[model samples]
Every structure is written in C-alpha cells, then in structure tokens.
Target: MESVFEAFLSFYLNPGFFYGTVLVVLLILFISIFYRLFPNSGFSILFDYFFEKMYDFFEDILGNEEKKWIKTYVVILFFVILISNLLGVFLEILVPVFGNIADTDVSLLKKYIDIPTADINFNIAMALIGLLIIIFEQFRALGFGKALYEYFPIFGKNYLPYTRGNLNPIFDWPLFILVKIFDLIISLFLGLLEIVGHFAKVISLSFRLFGNVTSGGMLLAMLVGAISGLTLTYLNFEFPVLGPVILYFQSLLVALIQALVFPLLIAIFIKVAKFA
Candidate 1:
C-alpha cells in the first residue's frame, strides 16, 4: 500500500492537493457558520475568554488602544498560515499534470500545484504584508516626525544637556559642533541598516512558515511508509490499520504547533515594532 501510494503520488494526478484545498475552504466555511449560528455557547465562552485575554495583553504593550486589534490581526494571519501548512499533508495525493511526464512530453507549471506555502513567493508575500502593517502601526503611534527622527538622530547646539546661561562659549560651542556632526553621520548609517532589516524580515518569515509545514508533512509521510513496510513484510496485511491513528495524532500536534507558533511570532513582532 505504501509503494502503491508513492507511485500514485509520483504521477501527475495529485488528488491530495485538490482534497486539501477543498478541506481548507470547507473548514473555514464551517467554522464561520458554526460561530455565527451559536453566537453564545460553551465554545463561544472559551473564545470570548481568549479574546479578552489577548485584548488585555496587547493593550498593556500598546497602551494606545484599550482594544486588542493587534491580537485580532495576528489571529487572522495565523489562520491563513495554518490552513496553508496543512495543505501539504494531502498535496502528495493530488495528481500533478507533469508528474509522469516523459522527455518528449510538453511541460506545464500548472500540472503541479503543491502546497502553496511551499513556494517562497507566497511566504515572502505574507511576511511583506505583515511588515507593512507593522510599519503603519509604528507611524500611527509615533507620528511621522518622531518616527523619522528615531532613524536619524540629528545633532546641533540643542544636542547636549548644557543651558544657554552657561558662559563657556569657547569650550561648549566648538565641542557641540563637532559632536553634532559625528552624531549625524552615525545616525544616517544606522537608519539605512534599519531599512535593510525590514527586507530581511520578509526572508525570515517566509522560510520559517514554509519549512515548518513541509517538514511536518514529510515526517508524517515517512512514518506511514515505515509502518506499512513493517506490516506488509511481517504480517502480510493489506493495511497497517494503525496508520491513520498515528498520523492523526502527529498531524494534530503539527497543526497546533504551527497555528500557535505563527501567531505568537506575529504578536512578538508587533511588540518589537510598536514598543521597542
């Protein structure tokens, strides 16, 4: 069965991809409907509890708004990332158009629709979007002038702690001019490094999401293959019987880790950008 499944996966008929996509859409739809129908339930109470907790957490960090809009943003980002990551678990079963292509056959990219998150472009886009939001939050909080000043600390007569009443022009005036010039140069370079760091965030965020999801699915696949190999050779069974159970448990762990990690990272980022 493992060999057969691998052969099927190797072929272009990637039913797993389609199934995963459908499952994601359905999952979101069902969750939406469920929440709408039962606006108040045991489940909803738990949801409200978390919402309040998140609100308070962000409120303490942000101090600007009593409401936890940051948490809400992080929640939505996590949901999208979680669904994309889970798509990998079934993507192999989905047939690809060129999976079995011969040397003479025409090649088309459309034939391969693996987990969308596996592609760097998708992950980078997600990170860029988050970075944009963070930038907006910073600007909104600090205002343009102050935010810009943070990146470029200018020096002048107003640079030091001395008062105008100090009658030490010979020492203070020349020292102030020299210090201000040095500060301006250093601040300018630091500002550029900060801007470059923004792009680095995109790379970090994208790779982290893609790597975690793909590796988790690959691990599950290996586990299934191992179990099937053992059962077929020793027990001569058609199915391992325990494959699904083990896979489900592993999947649950992966799903929860990915979901929690992504959002938690986002929240941390919000704190860094907004507060730090």
Candidate 2:
C-alpha cells in the first residue's frame, strides 16, 4: 500500500509536471478575462469572423449533403486537429527550459503535450472508423444489396456483367459452363482487389496525415537544436521559447491546411460512396 502511494505521489508531483497544466489554465483565464473586460472587443469580432469563414469553407467542401451535422462535425474535427498540432509546438522549448531547473532528471515535455495526430496508429484508427461510418451511410442510403455491389461490383460490366452472353437459347452447355468458371475466377480476383484497395486507402490516408504532422514537429525541433546554444539557451537568461514560438506561428498555416484537407477527403469519399 505504501509503495503504491509513493508511486502515485512521485507521478503526481514530478518535476516540471505542472508547467503545462498551469499554462493551459492561464490561457483559459486570459480568454475569459478578455471576454469579461471588453464584451465588444475587436478580438472577439476577429475570432467570430475566423470561425464563420472556417464554417463556410468546410460547408463548401462538403457540398449540399443531407446530413448537415456532418459539416459541423468536420468543423469540430478541424478544430481538434488544429489545437492538437498547435499544442505540440512548444515541445522543443518545454523540456529545455525546465530540464535544468529541477535537480531530478525528468523534463517538462515528458510530462506534457502529446500530439495525437503524429501517431500513425491514432490516424489509422480514425481512418478505419471514418470508413466504417461511410459504409454505414452507404448502407442507409442505398440498401444492402446495392451497397455491397458498390464495393465488389462482382458482376462488373467489363469483367463478367453476366455469363449469360455465352449462355443463350442455342444452349451451348459446355461453352456456358467454361465461361461461368472463368468468370468465377475473375470475380474472385476483383473482389480481392477491391478489399485490398480499401485497406490501401486507409493506410495511405493515415500515413499522409502522420507524415505531415511529424515532419512539422521535427522541423521545429531541428531548428531549435541548431541554435539552442547561440540564442535559445537556458544559461543565457532567455526564455528559450522564441525560436519554437516563431516556428509555431509559421506552422499555423499547415495546421489549418491539414485540418481542412483531412476532413474534405473523408467527405469526398462519403459523397462518392453515396452516389457511385
């Protein structure tokens, strides 16, 4: 019991652990304070305008879908992803600033700031779930038989369409049987191809999102490391945050682009699945 308590205490009160929590609290306080101090401030207007533009942008990309909630969903997804990416910006500075402050070995970054988008597994899981939702939508819109046909299209026009072309009133039995066998093989092959294609789409989409996010984070880390001694120094009585902070601002565009793109692709896929 004592060992467990000790472990919990160590984890809870670890060095540099509260920095991120404190910063998050401060940020929330700042925003609330702004709203309180100036109810009609330009900052509030600018923020509202930005959100309105984001809503319109997503709505345009999503088109006039019946599920209007999906547009709201995409907007929410964009915000979640953008916030996650932006939160990871300070990782390069977080550890450096506090690593030496504590006599213990643990660092600030170790305790705080996990960018979920950078994880391929997280992205892949999201892709899988999103694909599942699309499939469900297709089923709901097109009924069972047709939805299955959309994927397999086993009686595909070019492949088989039907073996009846070889089996006519003349009753060429052997030729008909041969054609049926051949088409069975073709249908099996095409079905497998379709399955593989679905899996490939999930992998490709997940990897693309993962690569973009991780690359941005690594670029900032590399730039910070390059000048950690010259300017971004803990010993130089500096905050060690400027380089990372600038890189953070620079990354905002990519964050927005990625947030917009990921959902747009999913929406496009859903639309195609519904109509195709």
Candidate 3:
C-alpha cells in the first residue's frame, strides 16, 4: 500500500506528464485552427497539389499510383512530427517554483517545454491512428472478401482432389481439410502476434524519442557543469558563458532531428499500411 501510494504520488508530480498534457492541448488548438481555416475540401486540394509534387520527386524511386500515394503520406507526416517535437524549444525559459509550509518545496513549473513523442501514450495513440488509416487503405484496395482471404487462405475444390491414382482419395481429402484447419488456427494466432508487435513498436518509438532527447540534455548539462567547474577551480568561478552558447546550438540541431523523425516515421507507417 505504501509503495503504491508513493508510485501514484510520483506519477502525479511528474513534470513530463503535466508538460505532455499541456503540449497536447496546445497542439489540438493549432490543429483546430488549421481545420477552421481550411475545411476538408480546401485542404484536400492543397494536399493534392503538393502531394503531386512530392510524387514527382519520388518518381525515380517508386513506380505507379500506389507508390506515389505512400510518398505523399510520408511528406505530410514529416511536418506534423517535426512541429510537435520542437514545441519544447519555445519554453526553454520560464522554470516553475513551488513552495509549501511544511517543507518549503520548490518545483519547476515550466510555462513551456514539452517533448510530445517522449510520452509513450502519445506515441501509441499516433501509431493507432496510423494503423486505422492503413486498415482503411487495405479495405479500399481489396474490398472485404479479398482482405479476408489475404489473411485467411482457403484452397478451392477446383484446384485439388486429382492425380491420386497411387493414393487413397478419401484419406487425402481429410488430410487436406485438417491442414487448412490448422492453417486457420495459425492465422488467428499470427493476427494476435501482429497486434502485440504494433504495441511494441509504440513502446520502442516512445522510448527512442525520450531517450535521445533526455540523454542529449544530460550531456549538455554535464558539459556546462564541467566547464563551470574547471573555471571555478582555476579562477573565482566567473561563468561558463560559452558553454550555454555551444549547448544551445547542439540542442537546436537535436530538437530539429527529433521533430522531423516523428513525422517521417509516421509517413512511412502510412505507406506500409496501404500495402498491408
């Protein structure tokens, strides 16, 4: 009970959790604005025009309409992910402070600064959304019957039950039926595994983003600390002014990469879904 209480308290007090929630809210606001400014029809036209240009760029790499569609999605995904990742950059300043009567606690209440992809829930939610898009594409491509057949293979009578002069015909039919039954059962299990794998992707994606960003920040913090320590050791610790400048540039590059990666991967996911 005590451990559970402590765990709950830690989760509630987590800065990342709160920051992620705030960032999500802000993202929704911007998305709403975009929708309000350009309704589906208008956005579709704009997307189509750009999508065509993108398709042309990938002309050498991918052939046919199917390939072009995937390329189009990838481009759009890059933008969304990139923007969300960098939302933290604007909140580099404005650290929060909390105080209490019992222990005079101080908490960093950041006005801004959130790495959306760092949260597992956020990554999983996006992946699930992408999965839906993929399923929709599959439905559009093959219709219901073909899609079902693709997952569940069934041999027809026309293709079998012949050229059996040397074997028992009755026995062969039962054997074939049993084989198909096993195949169907295996297919069901395979489907379950696929679902689990998708969830695994979400976990990996979230951890990758979180690990990269936090690790980079820690590195920069260490650099700054080391530089300041050396300065203090040699001379009355004036300030590691240059450390901030260098770290800031490094942070900028890292932030940009993370921002781009999120959307790029999403686009790839969309493309893969179409084929599935």
Q: What is the C-alpha RMSD of each candidate to the true structure, in Å?
A: 7.7, 5.8, 8.0
Candidate with top lDDT is 2
The whole-model C-alpha lDDT of candidate 2 against the native structure comes to 0.67
TM-score of 1: 0.67
What are the lDDT scores of the predictions, listed in order?
0.63, 0.67, 0.58
Model 2 ranges off by over 4 Å:
1-44, 93-95, 99-107, 152-184, 229-246
Give the per-residue lDDT of model 2 (tens digit) for 36-129: 7886899877766776787787677657654777777766666666665565565644656655326653344654444667667767977897
> What are the per-residue Cα lDDT tens digits for candidate 3 across 1-276?
448855674667555555566665677577658766776767656855755665564443333555555565655555455555455443332221221124532214331234565556666776666566656666677688765654444432222334333458778677767756676666666656656766766666666777776576557556766786888889776456677677767777887777556555555554565565
Model 1 is weakest, by summed lDDT over 10 consecutive residues, at 92-101
Order by TM-score, highest first = 2, 1, 3
State in Å the error of residue 69, model 1. Answer: 3.7
Q: Which is the better candidate, 2 or 3, if ranked by TM-score?
A: 2
lDDT, residue 15, candidate 3 = 56
Evaluated at residue 123, the lDDT of candidate 3 is 63
